[model samples]
Target chain A: MGPLIPYDIIPFEWSSIIAIIIGLCFGFILEASGFSSSRKLAGVFYGYDFAVFKVFFTAAIVSLIGLLYMDYLGHIDISMLYIHPTYLWGAIIGGAIMGIGFIAGGFCPGTSLSAVAIGKIDAIINVLGIMVGVFIFSELYPLFEPIYNGYFYGNITLEDSLGINPYWFVFILTIVAIIMFAVTDMIRKRVKKVFY
Target chain B: MVNRKLVKFLSLRYKILAFIFIVLAGGLVLLPKHEKQEGISPEKLLANTINPERYISTDALAEKMINQDPSLLLIDVRNESDYKKYTLTNAINIPLKNILDEESEPYLNQDAYDVILFSNDHFHADQAWILCTRLGYKNLHVLNGGINSWYNTIINPKMPTEDMAHTEFELYAFRKAASMYFGVAYPEKVKKATVIKPVTKPSITAAPKKVIVKKKKKKLPIEGGC
Candidate 1:
């Protein structure tokens, strides 16, 4: 269970510092890659840009494949990795709300934080919106409990539930990502240009 | 052939594509994450299940019981009814059903104890070890040969001599019964009769696996209990 901090290899005190450093790098890469702009983030919804999709999908696939490879190499056990529990309704409802949040605020949590680092006023607004969202969620936690804790299937990964080799899954995901990247590029070429 | 078209040229979103190589590069760094190679196999587990860590041993465990370390969370992976008969001092109850529930209040926000699981044979403890390890719980250890080895090594070091006193043998038998019940008894069977006189052999004996499980180097007093 690589939460390296828990193993005591790295002390927990460093987690925040580590998080900030990771965030800084994340923000730097994200903003430098043009995620700071609201229009860019919203392009996915309006069929103008797929950069957000490409970056996120690529990262997920890469990490999945890399972690699985590490498992195969025996440097780590794949079984120990954390899996977000599947909440069927949460996935659908929470995802829809997030999509709305994405379209309205034009900054998801990470991008907004990165944009805030660079001192974007709109990004600051988006962040405040997020805090309000967080507060609302907490206040209404009881009402949201049905989706939040309803469909717990236990800590499960794709490999654990599907009974497929992680390597195979990662390989498939990588191939799918590559195909999406290529397809998206083609689609972007044809879409009506929306200059921001 | 033509100057960049407006759609391809105008949007900053295409910049996200530039980092495709970066993601692949990140994978390179993650591949060698763990310094130690995991050599997990059923055979290795079968071979090394009873093989005790140098820090853990029968004498050390027995000594720990005597001193009574509060930090020690000695778990008996056996069933419940056996536990009721008698258990070591200050030991808590958690059978194999949710053995990993040391912090099992998963649904609720609660702190679970640091639990150690033991069984009659090292096999049970070892099995629990595998299960917990897979589940990613930290700080788990096997109690060598659960209660069986404890009876063989720590509780009784000498063969039952003809002159072995009845009361001493009774004490050992009582402790043995406690160990078995606490360490392995599941399904909650009532305590067995306190038959203490010299008997033909111990009811629970760990053979072939005996030497490795119970016969490892004894733990010195320097390191605290198992």
Candidate 2:
């Protein structure tokens, strides 16, 4: 039934407004969950705090299971959903850069933005760094174009790539996530806490 | 002593979280596995089936063609051999079998054009329409009565009787003009010579063939990502 704008069930003109509303809610939730604090975010790497891991993993699993249920009940046509195309080398290289940035600066892009909303000076610098990186990438696009566009595996899901049943995949993933959560709690207790 | 230590490690909050996860996993395990459905629900398809708005009449299509409507996209769903034999001006051939192919996606899935599907008759075109509509394509239409109707109405319109309404005569005149516009020859309009040349072969009045060159398929730019 949905992917409403594509189906013309919801007029395309309202898309921008809807996006703004969703973005606002997302930012509000991020700030409320203490994601705006750089120390809490960086603690995941130090084994002192696992809030980031728990929250994001739970969000992923919840959305996955919810979407599956919705599809089964015929509330939405899951096939109509847009999936971001995968670029293999681009993802690997970009992920490495983002991980380094997250460890060093203590904020990812989305959390940095939420921090900036609360007037954090560090977040402002991080945002500026991100813009500079974007500018550099744009300027050197021709040089990076090969890696950026190479090894494109068109939009696909676990079902397509791994040939696994989505239901079983989600169930296994939930169990793994719960085990990880318990393990992280134990690790946090053993590690010396760093006061922010 | 080991059991006490394990119980102490698993706090109340952890126990509750584990319980919730177990329930959710149980639910997921119980869900019946099915193949991914690429089509819309049958009820919605039925609703679209009963709606007559999906069919565009030949006269409306002819008018759109004459006016050079930018949004008009005529898809001849007949096979290549039949398509090459004769087709409407500027109509692209996307055979019924290949309607669901990746190459046909850019043409059928876009909203920029009023994509009209047609065949020799309504059968093949309707099948194409159903396939596309099932995939939730927008701005799609079936050419009512297909090419046979186009031949009867636009190519060789019957003269209306005197008892018929004025609108019928007007429609007939429009059709005759349209037939001429589409390059139909009238044998009766030819002047007779004193010496009649013997007809070698029986005249077969075929519609002028206009082959539309297919454009190279390019991937459509998809929107909506973070």
Every model's DockQ: 0.06, 0.52
lDDT by residue (tens digit), candidate 1, B1-226: 3456765665645455545544554454455444653334455555454445512555556656655655467776677886777555565556667665655423112234344566767676677677655443455666766766666765544434335556555444455554553454521222222222323556543232343334233222212231
What's the number of clashes in each of the models? 5, 0
TM-score of chain A of each: 0.89, 0.97
Query: How many Å off is the CA of B144 in candidate 2?
Result: 4.1
* Candidate 1 CAPRI-style tier: incorrect
lDDT of 1 by residue, A89-127 (tens): 888898999989999989888889888988999999989
- Per-prediction TM-score to the true structure, in the order listed: 0.54, 0.67
Per-model lDDT: 0.65, 0.86
